[model samples]
Target chain A: MKISLFATCLSDAFFPRVSEAMARLLARYGIRLTFPEGQTCCGQPAFNSGYWVEAKEAARRLIDAFRDSDYVIAPSGSCISMIHHHYPALFRDDPAELRMARELAEKSYEFSQFLVGVLGVSDVGARFPHRVTYHPSCHGSRLLGVKDEPLTLLSHVRDLDFVPLPFAEDCCGFGGTFAVKMADISAAMVTEKADHVRETEAEVLVGLDMGCLMNIGGRMRHRGQAVRVMHLAELLYEGVRMADERA
Target chain B: MSGHNPTSTLAERVRIALNNDFLRNAVRFTTERLRTNKQAAAEQIGNWEEWRERGRQIRLHTIAHLDYYLAQFAENLRRAGGYVHFASTAEEAVAITLQIMAAKQAKSVVKSKSMVSEEVHINQALEEQGIETVETDLGEYIIQLAGETPSHIIIPAIHKNKAQVAELFSEVAGEPLPADTAVLAAFARSKLRGKFLEADIGMTGCNFAIAESGSIVLFSNEGNARMVSTVPRTQITMMGMERILPSWEDLEVMATLLPRSATGQKLTVYMSAINGPRRTADGDGPDELHVIIIDNGRSRQLGDPEFQEVLNCIRCGACLNACPVYRHIGGHAYGWVYSGPIGAVLTPVLNEEKEKWAEVANASTLCGACYEACPVKIPLHDMLVYIRRRNVEEGRTKRTERLGMKTYKVAVSSHRFYQLALKLGRIGQKPLVRDGQIPTRLGPLKGWNNVRTAPALAERSFRESWQALERELQQEMAEMSPQVKARLEELAGKRGDRHEQ
Candidate 1:
């Protein structure tokens, strides 16, 4: 079965390290994850903003790019959510594309889901020593039902102090264009979320989705916080590196 | 902005709500408590998903055969000696209500908390005809005293504090009242009790109307819904046409989900299931009953696949309490009878003023909190997107957003333009990046940068480095265990079977 990496636009453009960490970490299991460069985005920005035609334009490319891949892995659950939930609806008028979209949706998995769920590798034989709190991205947990996979992965990290972030289930107000359109309300929400993050007092703040991490981490930066904001993949990869050095 | 002047733009409405510290704190504190309690309650209920699914199935089944059920309901209600009036619009509903009041010679009307009544502007119509109408539900009473609409579906006065309630009560009492909860409750209880005893007619909103028994169910913590349906000589119920359950068994499922989702109660303090007006053998029931089944744009959703499930909402306010946006801005920012996520979707669609109410749909982060919290799982996040799609399709979206989306289409239509855009973004942000962050509050970044810094684009896009990364990983490839391989194939096989179904 061909497995392709769907490095979401955010993961692709701004946080390539997350994709690198994800690829590097998965390789420990001998799984060769392929990258289909023809993929640009899952079209969530336009889709959520109400431009279905534009969203469909982007979706069509994605459908074409990964047509032959047996399984698809995306770092961001929000993009995976779009592929699983909206792609079929977006391409309902075209039978061939719709069938492909359905198959793609069935096979696509968020990174942690691909790890803990598919591979059944929670520990990944990694160790990290730091105070870490997780902000479960809203789309990842709520929309995609990716509740336990991340937690299951986190529980296996050696010496990883997992303090829960307060109101961690709450959105970071980064609804793609929502941050731009409803600025003040989004600001207030992110401020509250940042305050909760500060309350955790953890050395590292980790999450699953880059879009949300950007929103919350951006607020932390705006507040002059030095708390490290890393994706779970990066943290796991670093932990594996630490484990290797200690060994 | 549930009560804000309709002319105010969503930004202006959001500005007002955000700026008011008192309103913000009150809304946030109350919703936090309600949300926490609801979480605990859902956990205690064990098998919350099963209950949610049951409620969803009941509603879906009823709505699918709504025409049959509605006709059966009218016939059953008529057989029970209850007068059923069908009103296709708000105006017609209001006219029917006025006609009932006129026929009964109703000089005064006492009402329980009724969202449908608020939707129809019932008090205004009654007051214009020189009929005295008083709200008996504590929250509704406070809102009535202030001459404002309810900001919340469950907690109508969620935005008000004790001091505000005391101040509102002080004017009614003709004396200064202390800002104490018990004292205010005593004042309202005494004041509303008199109205209930003296009023000629009682008005209520139906929570669920049972078709088989020809009964209307009322769920209330305040016990005022009981009084409104009882004490008065005449009773008038304003039922949203969509509020119907096929039987008492379905009601049992609804009863399980509504209160737990609303306020964390297993059951409301008073769960009154009234089967028509009264029998001669009944001692303290209304002499006459008028059930006004108001369509008022509800039937518009009946045939619509996108919006039909919105009718499945049990008016529990779970979405309001769970919504991060509603928690910050309060209900008035929505500027409608309904507020929060439900308000965001319905205010535009129900009003059929998609162009006018377009911005209401923009207020959410599409987080799916509302859907997760909904008793029947309405998929409000998806609906919000659909509402936005409708707006965009009708050209109701902003010019800038339209242009931005158009540009996005061109950018992501293929990888070449996408690569160039990434390169341009990196180059463009070089001047803006301070310590690897764009802290500038200028141009399009103004809204975002006002509260958060922005990130500089990666030096190398993922695709740019994909070839090298693939080459690097090839050598390090470990042998996969056959068991792991089999498990993955089995999972994939199961997924394939699901798609065929």
Candidate 2:
């Protein structure tokens, strides 16, 4: 399919490889991938921070950027939810803005949602011999209503042992600006999440969003923990393609 | 800043809380333990979501027909010889309560944990009237002794460590006490049991007031709620207007959801449904039962679309456990009776000063974990945004923010202005850029970048890079497999239709 990638500002600056891996994997599935450059952010920071006007402006830019795309797929569940669920509310009183928001919401999909729902492929003939646990990002699990798609795909991976992380649905406290704004509380929350990870005795931890993975990964690093964090896309991209083709 | 001010900003109060290193640590330990227990319990339940949904539906139904259920509840309570009073405001509620205290000639009172009482600052009012009021809930008692408000709903003294608690208890015991849960609990039980027995009045918060039976339900892990309800000659129950459920059938769903969501228990140590004061035939119940239903600004949201669902909250503290904001700063930072996602919405919506409470809404990532954790399925994230929108709509945002938004609104409405702004931004950000990241923690970026650097604008924006790659793919496809190209078009067409549909 002609997939317009909203690499999300986080991926653009820090995790470009997640964006690259997504492109290659979808391309291998014979999908035409396009990038719409007019995008900057989904305007979540402003929106979440009570800056409605700034958020509306950002949302307008995002909608305009992907207006012509066949499918607007974002790697982050939180941001995609912002577009799909919240953007419409931002323009609740204005029919024109509301209409534009509805279109964007219809087009937007999280990376995993796009892969599992739109593409309808649970198995990519991938193999990974390791024990891993998954942390379902709050937005994806609750807001976006993606409960088992990621698990459905993961369970199909060959030779992989999936140990369920206790308190897997509990937030790891990477609340965008919330980490810094409430540093002590955030640190404590992540500590509990880290403990849960340790309890699982899994060598690998996988999640959908890089923001959460980064926060949990950073804390894991601080504690000198050996558990490695990987995005679900990277795992699927691993054995689905030849070594050199994998991002 | 306003009438009867507490002599400190909410931020200042939180600062005091934060400085108490002991408080911070204790809160961390308690919340961590509670969160873990909740997870384990949910895991054991298996069909946790279904139960949550059923719980949510019951609440939704009850709240939707609140007037009908409340009337039924009050009628049933009255029929059972319970006196039911509805207070339209905090002042009216306090007046009614004080009137009852006077009529009973109450000298001493014992209380169970009640967020509604906290909202009314009932103890402060009672103390001013020369009445000795004792908080019986272990956590509430600790905070009451410390002369501080509760920092958490479930664990009121969650902010105090064992040593601090021992110190507080020692002062009352006239001797040194050990910093042990068992020892402290025993001391508290002994001390509070006397107060419960001697007190003229017993006060408790109603978790749910069943409409059909005219009963007030209390879900407590500790037995104090029951003790307070049974021992005193007179029982006074305080409940928010939203605390109504239609029937005992719905109570089954609530019984399932409340304990599991709150502390992840299959059942609390005690879940009592008191129909009225002690019956003529019953031996150990309160002789006189009085229920005070307080609106206290809750009635303002009765028919409002954006906020009506907030009334469905069961005070289970599940949202607080799931909230990233509360997970970080704890409850005091919220600066109000409620905290976490529910608090963020409630503090402002319920408070008269919209400006003072508006900042609480900014404390979320809008990630919606609270919605997931909520047994009643309140869309707190969405409500947070609505609160923000109202702040802007009412012209409460700062001047700088207002101006910035004006410029943003103008620049983003069209591609022409947007392209110019982007080109300008790329050049403008150059001076602020350092080490492939925007290091300027100034203006709007201050709040975000205070802890993490803003990643610099990508060397090539994703949109720019994708266009170049797509162009290359188009040419390469002309020389590539036709079957693959056809499949690509077919899938793309299907996706497009889905988007349209």
Q: Return the top candidate by DockQ.
A: 1
lDDT for each residue of candidate 2 in B384-415, tens digit (9 for 90 to 100): 87887788788876787677667766665564
TM-score of each: 0.97, 0.86
For model 1, residues B1-501, the per-residue Cα lDDT tens digits are 136578888899899999999999999999999989898999998999999999999999999998888898989988988999999989999999999998888899999888998889899999999999999999999988898889999999999999999999999999999999999999999988889999999999999999988888999988999999999989999999889999999999998899999999888899998888889899788988889999888999988989999988889999999999999999998987899999998898889666778889999999999999999999999999999898888888778888888889999998999999998888888887777788999999999988889998888888899889889889888787898889878987897788778
Estimate, for each residue in A144-174, the C-alpha lDDT of model 1 and write its tens digit.
8999998888899999999999888888898
Tell me the TM-score of model 1. 0.97
**Could you tell me how far off, in angstroms, the CA of residue B210 lies in candidate 2 after the best superposition?**
1.9
lDDT of 2 by residue, A1-247 (tens): 3468888767865677678777766666666667766676788767765677778777888888888876888778988988877887788989988987887787788988877886677886787778999999987777888889889989998778999998787778777755755555456667778889999989999988888887787677656788988888888887565433543
Cand. 1: chain B TM-score: 0.96
- The prediction achieving the highest TM-score against the true structure is 1
Clashing pairs in 1: B1-B332, B1-B333, B1-B334, B1-B335, B2-B332, B2-B335, B2-B336
* Collision count of model 2: 6
Model 1 lDDT, residue B400, Cα: 85
Q: Worst lDDT window (10 residues) for model 2 chain B? A: B1-10
RMSD vs true structure, all candidates = 1.7, 4.5
